[model samples]
Target: MMGALGQSFINGITIGSSYALVAVGFTLIFGVLRVVYLSHAAVLAACAYIGYGVIEVTNSAVAAIVVATLAGAVLGVVIERIAIRPVRGQNHLIPMVTSISVAIIIEETLRLTVLSGQPISYPDTFASTVIRLHVGGAEPYFTVGQVLIFALTLALVLTLRVVVQRTWVGRAMRAVADSEDVSSLLGVRVNVTSARTMALASMLAGAAGVLLALSIGAIDAHFAEPLQFKALAIVLFAGLGSIPGAVVGGYLLGFVEAFAAGYLDTSYRDLFAYVLMIAILMMRPQGLFGRRLTQRV
Candidate 1:
């Protein structure tokens, strides 16, 4: 029993790391743009497919990752300029609706063009590699894919922390998040800052998408839908705009799902996340790290 539990814990952490990547991107976009950016899932899928294509040509995972990240960043800029910028500061519902429409368009386009609504297997880069770790009397193992996910996630998270805490663009992003109007008045280029934020967030999402495809060994057109919901739950669980909260919430959700699947029913794994989400919403709507705002007249 202890052996099984240890194995499950390892699996949970590996999966949770991927969720943390997606959730962090979700929170970053929300913090900067104040929009849900529902098309994030679509962007993820698109980048994954792009990565797959690059791998097919170059057979280099590194090249695929770089190309996909760039593609996602460019897509983010396009989405912002074409779909989001025009709707900025309008009724919040407008941007939300536009994002949904954009998501649908991206999904459908992928379905009709390259993906054909089918599952495409990723190249067998690390599928056969496994690291065996002996912990006590139990032997818990991790796949090379899982190890890469964990390492990349850690690196990305630390890089993001540095960017947010130590860079000029990061400062601009924080200022814009505080108040776009005030930031602009203070000579901050609000448009440029927003664009930079979107690029960074989308690049993260792209990396996540590629990692997910590598982990699962396949890319499916509809793969992003459930992930999108999971990411949303993580964001809400952590607090809408808190980066640290998103990471913690993501791991929490991943562990809950992993445990539920390993010990309970696999079919009910997704239920745990929604249940936790509801519990958090009811108990502390502001989220674990969220601060309640006091409006003044």
Candidate 2:
């Protein structure tokens, strides 16, 4: 029982780390633009396919990841320029509706053309090897892919923290998030900041999509939908714009999923996630780290 528990814990952490990556992207766009980017999942799926193509040509996972990241970043900028920018400052629902339309177009395009509405096997990489670790009386085993996911997630989160808190672009992003008009008055390039925010968010989503596909060994156009929803829940759980909260909420949700699947049924894993989200909202509507809202009469 202990062994099984330990294994589930490890698996949960791995899965949750991926969730964190996606959630962070969601948080970034929301913080900067205040628009719910419904197209992010489509972006993730599109990038995964792009990664697959890169692997087919170069046969290098590293190359695939690099190309996919760049593609996602470019796509992010394009989406912002074409779809989002036009709707900016409109009713909040306008951008959201636009994003949904864009997501549908992208998904259908992939399904009809490249993906053909079928799942594609990810290129085999570190997934082929399993590393066993012995600690005291507990021997837990993990795949190279899982280890890579965890390590990369840690590094990415740390780097994101530094970028958001210390860098000039990060400062610009925060300023824009606070007040776009004020930031522009203060000489911050609002357009450039928005573009960079989208790029960074999309890159993170792209990396998560590729790594997650590699971990699972297969991906389809629909694969990112559930992940997108989970990312939303995680972002809310972590606090809307709090990067660290996103990370922690991601791992917490992961553990919930892993333990639930391990001890119960896999079908209930998503249910558990929703239930947890509801419970958290009921207990703390502002999220674990979010600030309470105030309005002047």
Candidate 3:
């Protein structure tokens, strides 16, 4: 009983940490762009596939992660220039539509070009280690994969925090987030900063995707679709433009899904997330960490 509960909580945190990493990128883009990039999930999926393919060819996860990050960074810049830049000053709705269209195009192209006939598996380098634990009177153990996930997640989060809060680019990003016009007037190069922000966000997403592939041991285009809603729900629940908020929201959502699956049924795992999101939205539209806006007449 107590052991099972403790194990469930640990499982929840592990799943939530991955979600937190992915959600941070989503929240960052929204904070800087002020427009929802629906293609984020698609980009993440593509990066994962690219990483898996590279690993298959070179048999090196490190090499694969590097290549995937570069690819995602370049693709993020391209998407910003072509699909997002032109509609920058315009209403967010236009950019939102454009992003969705780009998502569909990317999805179909991946399906046609990559999965022509066969599917691919993301071979794991640490799949053999087994670690078990006994707590109280119930059964719930941990594995090396779960341990690796936690370590990778912690490293990524710490790296992001340091980069965003300690580095020069981080200062520029904060300035832009504070006020784009002022940042531009002060020689911040708002356009470049915004593009760089998108690139960084994409790289973060790529890292999360690679971690996800490592955990699941398979790569497929459709694999990222489900993540889209879950990631978005976390970001929205935490607050659309708050990075830390997204982290908290993601963990909460992850735990909810894990507990629901463990106690109820696996089929309703996603249902729990959506239901929780809807309930939160209905009760507090501003989200858990979002600031309440004041309108000026």
Alpha-carbon error at 261 in model 3, in Å? 0.4
lDDT of each: 0.85, 0.88, 0.80
lDDT of 2 by residue, 107-160 (tens): 999998974788899877655477887766878888877877788788878988
Ranking by TM-score: 2, 1, 3
Backbone clash total, candidate 1: 0
Error of 2 at 289 (Å): 0.5
Q: Enumerate residue pairs that collide in model 2.
A: none
Clashing pairs in 1: none
- Residue 120 lDDT in candidate 1: 94
Regions of candidate 3 where Cα sits further than 4 Å from its true position: 137-139
User: Is 2 or 3 the stronger prediction by lDDT?
Assistant: 2
Best-to-worst lDDT order: 2, 1, 3
> Cα RMSD (Å) between model 2 and the true structure?
1.7
Residue 21's C-alpha lDDT in candidate 2? 90
Per-residue lDDT value at 291 in model 3: 85
Find the 10 residues in a row with the least total lDDT in model 2: 122-131
**CA RMSD per model (angstroms):** 1.6, 1.7, 2.2
TM per candidate comes to: 0.94, 0.95, 0.90
